[model samples]
Target chain A: EDKVVQSPLSLVVHEGDTVTLNCSYEVTNFRSLLWYKQEKKAPTFLFMLTSSGIEKKSGRLSSILDKKELFSILNITATQTGDSAVYLCARTPNNAGNMLTFGGGTRLMVKP
Target chain B: DAGVTQSPTHLIKTRGQQVTLRCSPISGHKSVSWYQQVLGQGPQFIFQYYEKEERGRGNFPDRFSARQFPNYSSELNVNALLLGDSALYLCASSPGTSNNEQFFGPGTRLTVL
Candidate 1:
């Protein structure tokens, strides 16, 4: 079975404090890794990483994949209260029809 | 353009009742998929429809079924509902085939008593 595991299931930090969320997966045919932010409704896409050692960034949020290690990490710098949400990491296995196998998600709470 | 849209933002029903959830894909999107998200867990794929055809289906019971309209809109119907069937039904849309990014809707929350 394809599995995606996320670490530090829940985290609490103050404003301006940086945080790192981890995601590890084991799949037969690895295609790409996607990151999403879920607030109260649907998840909003953040980035899609398909190559190792290459970093994808959007403002204060950045993520990188390490295919060699079968894991990925999402980093949030200078965090704010607005960053409070559940961060989800999903992997699309080869020939999986683009439907993703998702992790349980990391719930981050940024205190101001 | 508008993002994915789902109808009946919330619904409540009793066990053994049947429920239908609706979704409208984004303009120009041809693929639509459905997922069930129970509280405290990630969404699980239920079905994927493309061009009015069933492209893929997950490990769901026969009680769950869906169909896509000619306009790319879709509906999810669940029969003999159980407490475990109560969850947030999400619909997502993508431009073409199975290799592209997907845009998601706000989801329909169904509660079974």
Candidate 2:
């Protein structure tokens, strides 16, 4: 079974504090890793990491993958209260047509 | 471009009842996938359809089924619903089967009482 594990199931940080979420996966025919932010019911797409070492960034959020180590990390700098949500990490297998195996997710609460 | 849209934001049913959830993918998208997410857990893959054909399915039981229409819209049917079936059913769409970036819908919260 393909499994994705996230660390620090939940976190509470101040508005200005920075946070890093970790995810490790063991999937067959690994293709890529994707990050999403779920605020209410819908999950908004963040970044899709396919190459290792190279980092992908958008505004204050960034992510990097280490395929060699089979792990990935998402960094959110200078967080705001609006950033409070569940961060999800999913892995796509090359053989499973568009199937995304997701982790339990990390709940982040950014205090004002 | 309207993204992916799902119908009936919320639904309630009882055990042994049947329910159907509908989804319309983004314009020009040819692939649609379904997922079920319980509270506090990430969404789990249920099925994938491309060009009105079923391409893949998850480990869900036979009671759960789905089909895509020629217009690229899809419907998920669950029969003999169990209390455990209460979940947020999500629908996603992509331009192609090989694309990993899928646009997700707002999801339908199904409550089985």
Best TM-score among the predictions, by candidate number: 2
Measured against the true two-chain complex, the DockQ scores of the candidates, in the order shown, are 0.64, 0.78
Per-residue CA lDDT of candidate 2, range B1-113, in tens?
59899989999999999999999999999999999999999999999999998998999999999999999999999999999999999999999888569989999999999
List, residue by residue over A49-109, the lDDT tens digit for candidate 1: 9999999999999999999999999999999999999998998767746777789999999
- Candidate 2 regions exceeding 4 Å error are none
Total backbone clashes of model 1? 0
Where model 1 places Cα greater than 4 Å from the true spot, the runs are none
Query: By summed lDDT, which 10 consecutive residues of candidate 2 chain A come out lowest?
Result: A92-101
Pairs clashing in candidate 1? none
Colliding residue pairs in candidate 2: none
Output the TM-score of candidate 2.
Answer: 0.98
Docking class of 1: medium
Question: How much of the true A–B contact set does each candidate keep?
Answer: 0.48, 0.75
